[model samples]
Target: MSVWDDLIGQEPLAHTLREAVAAARDRLSGGSGRGMTSAWLVTGPPGSGRSNAARAFAAALQCRDGGCGQCHDCHTALLGTHPNVTLVATDRLSIGVDSVRELVRSAALMPANGRWQVVVVEDADRLTEDSADALLKSLEEPSPRTVWMLCAPTAEDVLVTVRSRCRLLVLRTPSPPAITRMLVDRDGVPEVVAAFAARASQGHIGRARRLAHDEATRNRRREILRIPTSLIELGACMVAAANLHEVAQEEGQGVAATLDAKEVGDLEAIYGASARDGRARGYPGALSTLKKDQSKRRTRVVRDTIDGALIDLLSFYRDVLALQTGARTALVNDEVRADIDSLARRGSADSTLRRMEAVLKCREAIAANAAPLLALESMMLDLRV
Candidate 1:
């Protein structure tokens, strides 16, 4: 298997990256690196494998045999352990100026063992204004042997200045058939289960994998989709809002559990504060700062979870609209076709469009830091049948 094997339905992109790798190899072999780009901005929808592509490209550039997956160089490069590769993936809400400056410093170095010094930033969209500015000069005047690959959901999500200085690599969402095939072949999922997950995720690779394996995630999604059919009364709307909020909180907490505990324990040790000892002198402030960071992280996770639920709700209404309009496209929520038919019988296409608009508005409101429960309540009322 090559480094590009996991990049399903992206043969065009892999070909482009392979050409660049060949050019870089030419330079390493004392030829001009024509057609090779030193800076790259990888843009794609969520789960479209932007970071994965970047990692593959990085590994390929450093590999003599062009990312042969069996080699130690390929393994280490993919894992970000190769001496020539730097993977900047942050669990924090945003990348700061300090971190960007460190990367800038690293980008100034020559390659180890006469190869490329590769840097892959997994969340360029999360770079703060200051950090984005810090990254500008290095991108503009990168070292001859240094390569930078930055990933974001869309080109618009990244700073314009930063994006303009780099070559663009866009990834497309794989089709359901493609995704289903991959789940069965790679992850050894049952065909029926893989098909369901592929359709339900709407071609989101990561979510498809999760839904194929995790019963809890599927159950929660089912409950979320059930809201559209259950919003019969004003009281029911509020209840739905509360349930949505609770589910989002649980999702957020689930994501935070591992990293949060590790940080708390590390901070406690640093402050020398334990159950047996009294609070240390500077422990309170440090702990308070850590809590603030964790709160921001949790809020982001919660909002993202709710946003995902909102997207699912949109799909439900889309099915209803399709039925109402006598459209031929298959329902995204095929398992809920009966419910969708009932909704179609009860509402016109115009009403379905209005409800979808309301859902989109609710997503925007929550993204703007509005109270999630309040936004959800407003949306649920609008979605009432």
Candidate 2:
């Protein structure tokens, strides 16, 4: 097995990275790493496996056999447990200056394995302006044995200066068939369920897995898909919008439940504070900071859920448009073709396009930190036939 085994729909990209790994090995043996560099910027659409690509490359670089999956070097590097590997994946909304400076310090350290010190950042696009600026100097003049691998949703998402210092590689969305095959073969998901999840996810690998594995996730998606059919009166629009916000918040909370408690527990342990104790000295301010961070995290999570809901709606309307135009494309929501047909018969192609535009606008507004309920209400009204 190879580290690239799970990277579905990216055979060409895998080949490129393998070549880079060979060049990197040559560099370690006192030759020039012509095809590889100290810094790399990896960009891709959401769920295109950008982080996975980074981790796989990191493993390949550290592995003596160039990412043979059975090797200890490969296993540890992929798990972020290798002495020479550092993985930066933030739970917070943004990566600040302090975190970047800390990484810079780590990047300067010597490799314990005598190969390379690899740092893989899974969300480089979330870096704050100050953090990007702080990261600039290290990227501009990287250490000889230090490799910085950054992942972002797009090239434009990173600072031009930092981006310019790194070799750029872009990943494409995994085709639905590719995602379905991975789920069926690797995860043992049922073929039918895997197919539906893959088509519904529209190339997002993580969500497809969730949809395949979790019944509650499927139920919630079903509820959201039924929203358009419920938009009858003004009151119905208001209700539908409110229900969508609640649904997103509920989904977000499901994720936050475990993570939030663990964070609090870790903070209490660090400060030697307990619920039974009156309080530890300086704990209140630290607790306040933790609360703020948790709040920001919750907001971002809910907003992301809302954005996902909007995208699902976009797919529904797009199907309606496809039907109205007599296009023979397969529907993303083929299971609900009855409802789709009803919607398409009632609406013109122009109206379907307009509704899709509304969904796009709502997604943009929520991402820009607008009030979720308000934006959703406006969008629901626009979606009404």
TM-score against native, each model: 0.94, 0.96
Top candidate (TM-score) = 2
Model 2 regions more than 4 Å off? 273-281
Error of 2 at 372 (Å): 0.4
Candidate 1 C-alpha lDDT tens digits along 274-353: 52254577777777778888888899989988988998999999999999999999999998889999999999999999
Q: Please provide the root mean square deviation of candidate 1 (C-alpha atoms, Å).
A: 2.1
TM-score of 1: 0.94
Q: List the residue pairs that clash in candidate 1.
A: none
Worst 10 residues of 1 by lDDT: 270-279
Give candidate 2's TM-score. 0.96
Error of 1 at 65 (Å): 1.1
Cα misplacement distance, residue 62 of candidate 1 (Å): 1.6
Give the lDDT of residue 380 in candidate 2: 96
